[model samples]
Target chain A: MDMIRRTVLKSAGATGVVAGLLATGMLKPTLAYADDWNKAAFEAKNMDGALDGIGAKGAADNKDLLVKAPEIAENGAVVPVDVTSNIPNTTSIAFLIAKNPSPLAAQFEFSNGAVADVSVRLKFAETSIVRVVAKADGKFYSAQREVKVTAGGCGG
Target chain B: MADPMKIRAQMKGDVAEVRVLMSHAMETGTRKEADGKLVPAHHIQNMTVALNGKTVIAGQIAGSVSKNPVFGFKVKGAKAGDKVAVSWIDNKGDKRTDEAAVA
Candidate 1:
């Protein structure tokens, strides 16, 4: 707990210093880390509730995003997935596993000057809802897929 | 050892793509260990994602899933200059969350 707080504080200080420099014209130009979000607040018992908590709206009817997951997980330990979008100027990406002790599995930021892409590994407690949240132009959007696990992977 | 789930996502045009690999035992706690002790139930309850503080996608999970699951999805209407945040809380009362920016 203390360690987390210290880390947060240090990051805050660094951000403040950078902001000050930018304001004083001491720095040329660069992107900024978002300060208006918290990662621990949106967990829920189900999928829709979690989305509502994070202010995400699914574009299920939209044709811009594509998501894929295994129909049946051979083992309840590791499942692979992939998602791709044809949307222009993607700003952020993330993943979550519902049914695990922690719904939040992973997060990754993309370089503004680089392609909007991210990849990561996460732990799942069981077969659950997997969600990916994306932000573009200050708006929130997301995609979802279901995965099945066969064996016990966590304690093995 | 088995391979952990590998997940990846990319955004193009007006969509936010995402993916995940899940690692878990999904133990129902119905079985006993060698010592005859019943294992406790541990699983993920729910997960959610927000773009720029707005929740866009969510998932509901169950025990029927095998250990280590993989899932993927897409979010439409996304563009550049935004932030994506992901968070989850499990049945065991543990929670973890992280955020990424879109480009």
Candidate 2:
């Protein structure tokens, strides 16, 4: 069981590199990607960010998306998260941390008749915005919440 | 190891309540040891739950979850003694599958 979990963990870690793949062209650019559903703002410290990083600036009133994080993270090293969406025709979802080593956490895309709920664990170096964004039909919508990281959880 | 996933299934009328506890360190690739070496990022990537060989739930994931991830969902028209299977594939292509029957 440990062996299996270890493998899963290692694969889960590959997103940082997969997100980097577009930059190095280790993989082909997503020529088929649609712009409206593909957000770019939330990705970087600046505008020229990765497609996965962009999100709507504010979604305080968007009623379809649900974001959950502790008001205070007991361990900054590993924080728990849960996201769910009830928006019609939802096509994508993403998670971003305003103050991680990198802002991007993870992103997911849904196909025909897919469920819009997800949960995962992440690392936070400090207090940051926990943003969950969703693309519905042809428009982008998002919600940002804050998390306070107390102690670090990385191997350190 | 954080903790082995806790799995449970119950029946109330025709509803089945299924739950899972997955063990994961969920490292975010942004920390260092006392000696200052960066710890690699690790997390669970994909998970699917099936009822009696039919797909019921599937989701893409990343490392933004807590240690020992837990998820519960509802299934309609399920009966007691039906077999429900859960499978997970992490970022590195490691996959594990577990099954439980409704009681």
Candidate 3:
């Protein structure tokens, strides 16, 4: 009876594993849902090219997008940036450092009921406007704040 | 061996707040050492978060990210005891994965 019970437990565990995978839709190829990282955007030397690369070329400034960053960053090597968007259905948030060798710092895509809030530390080449662009409902909205750096982080 | 990434996932009113701290040098490849050799780019290029084996967040990060980066986000519908995992791939193809139980 003990051996039979052990076998039953093993099959139950296997069934649970299969059920979990089915419920999570893991059997499907979710790779199509994930957008590939845009290398061109990160390598763009100019803001326009970077913006165009990410399909955010004509983003309009929106008040709902809140960017929390220090007005004066004593160490350019590490600047803390917090971005929050109240716009409904936000799908992504991107960071751009105007004066960095590569203007695009990071791009984040939200899925599976993730909220539209992100925090990251970025390096700055010099004092520059830090821009946060949020995509919601297939429209791009952006807001910028100037952060003063006492020392450049990008080998200045 | 490199240190394991530190991760925390706590549920608050059906939303799991996930925070991850990864240890890396994040060299931008532009900095020169005292010997005048340029540091090769060695930063996390991709990161992803999964809840209960389902991806919730995926990100592309550049070398501008600071060394030992920290990231935080929220995932809806996660509860206490749910499995939350975080993984990252660096520019040199080094990868790390760590998991935590939502609390």
List the DockQ of the predictions in order: 0.06, 0.29, 0.34
Q: By DockQ thresholds, what CAPRI class is model 3?
A: acceptable
Candidate 3 displacement at residue B79 in angstroms? 0.9
Q: What is the interface RMSD of each candidate, in Å?
A: 12.5, 6.6, 5.3
Give candidate 3's whole-model lDDT: 0.84
lDDT of 2: 0.62
Comparing 2 with 3 on lDDT, the higher-scoring candidate is 3
Clashes counted in candidate 2 amount to 18
Clashes of 3: 0
User: Candidate 2's residue-wise lDDT over B9-99, tens digit each?
Assistant: 7875556767778877766555578899988766665667777878666655545555567775556577888888877755434457888
Task: Please give me the total number of clashing residue pairs in predicted model 1.
Answer: 64
Q: Regarding TM-score, does 1 or 2 come out ahead?
A: 2
Candidate 1 segments exceeding 4 Å error? A1-39, A42-54, A57-61, A152-156, B1-103
DockQ, candidate 3, vs. native dimer: 0.34
Report model 2's chain A TM-score. Answer: 0.62
- Top candidate on TM-score is 3
Q: Relative to the unseen true structure, what is the C-alpha lDDT of residue A103 in candidate 2, on a scale of 0 to 100?
A: 63
**Candidate with best lDDT:** 3
lDDT per residue for candidate 3 within A40-69, as digits (tens), equals: 798799888889988999999999999999
